[model samples]
Target: MFTSRERSLGKLVVERFRKRRAERINNLMVKEGAYWYDNFITRTSLLEGLSLLIPGLKFGEDVNDFRDLGNSNYRALLRALDKLDDHELQFFKTFINSHFYVCHATNNPAIATKKDMVLFSRRKLIEQDIKFNTYNTAYVDIAGLANDDNVFFSLEIGARPQKTIPGAGGSRFGNTYYKVAYTDPSFDFSSLYLFDQALMDIPQCKISDISEEAKAILNSRKYTRKSICFYGRKSLPALALSIISATRLLPERDRLVLLGCRTEKEKKRTAALSF
Candidate 1:
C-alpha cells in the first residue's frame, strides 16, 4: 500500500503546490452556508491563508456555478481567511486539509442527513480499516449480486431483504445503499499522500502494490476511500474528484466513469484493452 506521505516533496515544485491549493479549495465547498449551518466551518481562515501564501494559488474568475453558492458564504469564508497572517495561514491550511469526512447514509439511503453522514463516515472508516486490511488487502463492493429488482422487493418487503439475520432467501429486501470516507491522518500508505499533506491537501492515492497477477484477475486495479455513486446516484460520478467531473455526472452522460477512487487513489487497469 502507498500514500501521499511517501511521495517526494523535493524542492516544493510549484505544480505540486498548485495541486494542493486545488484540493484545499475543494474542501471549502462543503464548508459554506446552509451546509455550513449543519456541517459548520471549524477552520475559519485556513483556505484564504493557503491561497495567499502559496505562490501558485489564486481565486479563479467568478464562476457561474459557484455563484449559485450565494456570495455571502463565499465572502464570509474569504473574510475569515483574510484575518490570518502568512505563517498562520500555512498552519491553518495544513491542519484543515489533513482531516477527511466520510460521506454516508444511515439505514436511510434517500437522504444522508449531516449528522448521519458524520456518524456513518466515522464508523465506516473503522470498518474499512478492517475490511481493507483483510482479503489480502483487497476490498470489493460486490453489489452486483445484490442488484435484482426482485431482490430489492424481497429484501425490503418481499423475500430478498428477508432474513433480519445474515442469511438470504428470506421474506424481504431492504434498502442497502451505503457510503463513507476514510482517512489516514499520517500519510503512511503512500509517499504521494504525504506530499499532498505538505501542500495542504487531501491527497488521493494513485495505486497500491498489488501484483500484476492480481490486477489481471480482478479486471480492475483500483479500490477507494470514497465513491462517486451513493444512494440512488451510482450514475453520478464522484463530482468532488473534479469540479468538471461533477458537472459531467449530472443526469447527462451514460458513459460516465465510476467516481469511486476513494478520494484520490486510483486503481489502474494495467493490462492492455483487447477486443
Candidate 2:
C-alpha cells in the first residue's frame, strides 16, 4: 500500500516523462517534414527554372537529352550565353550554379612546348543540405501523389474505406479515381495561393556557390554571433535564397544562420550566412 504523497510523486514523474517523450517525437516529426518540404521545393524550383531556360525540358525524362544537347553544343551554348543581357546572364548563372556542378580542369600538362588550357565541365548537382527551419512554414503539394485515388476517397468518406460495388464479373478489381474536395476546416487550403505569390517575387543573386574556405572563414567567431549547421556540396545557393525568402515569414527578432558542410566527416568545418 502506497501513501497518497508517494502516489502523487509517481504520477508527476510519469507525466513529466510523457511530456518529454511527446516533445521529442514532435521535434523529430517537424525535422522530417521540413526535410521533405525542402527537397520538394528545391527539386521543383530546379525543374521550373530549367523549363524556363530550355523549353520542352521535362524532369526525369529530358535530363539526359539536355545533357547531350549541352555537350554537343558546348561552343554554341557559350556564344549564346555571351549574347544574354546582364539580367538574363545573372539568372542563367544562378540556375546553373543551383542545378549543376561547374568543374575546371587543366589539359596538355605533359606537353612542355604547348601551353596548358583550362576546360570547363558541368555535372549534375547532388548532396543538397537538409533543412532545419520548420516553424511557420507552409507547403502545398501542387503535384499530388500518383496513387492517391484511395486516399482522396477515404478523405471524402470521413476516413472510412469504401467497399467496391460488385461488377458483372463479380467484384472485379479496377481503379477508382476521386477528385479532391477540400472540405476539411482544420486545413487551410487557401494557403496554396502563397506558392504563386512566392513565384512572383523570386530574388536573383550575382554570385553562387560560396567556397568551402570562405565558408570556414565565415564560421569564425568574428563573423558569426550564432550559427545553425547544414550539410551539402551543391544547392547551397538555392538553400540560401530560400532562407532569405522565408525570413519574411519569421518574426523580426528571429534571424537565420547558414552553415555549409560538404560531408558529415567535415561537420566541424562550418559556415555562416547571417540575416
**lDDT (CA) per prediction:** 0.25, 0.27
Q: Model 1: residues >4 Å from true position, as ranges?
A: 1-71, 80-83, 108-179, 182-275
Top of the candidates by lDDT? 2
Q: Tell me the alpha-carbon RMSD of every candidate.
A: 23.2, 27.1
Give a tens-digit lDDT track for model 1, residues 40-153: 121333443333233433233322222233233334334444454443344333322432322211242334456442222222434546222222111111111111111111
Worst 10-residue lDDT window, candidate 2: 145-154
Separate clash counts for every candidate? 45, 0
Prediction 1 TM-score vs. true? 0.18
Best by TM-score: 1
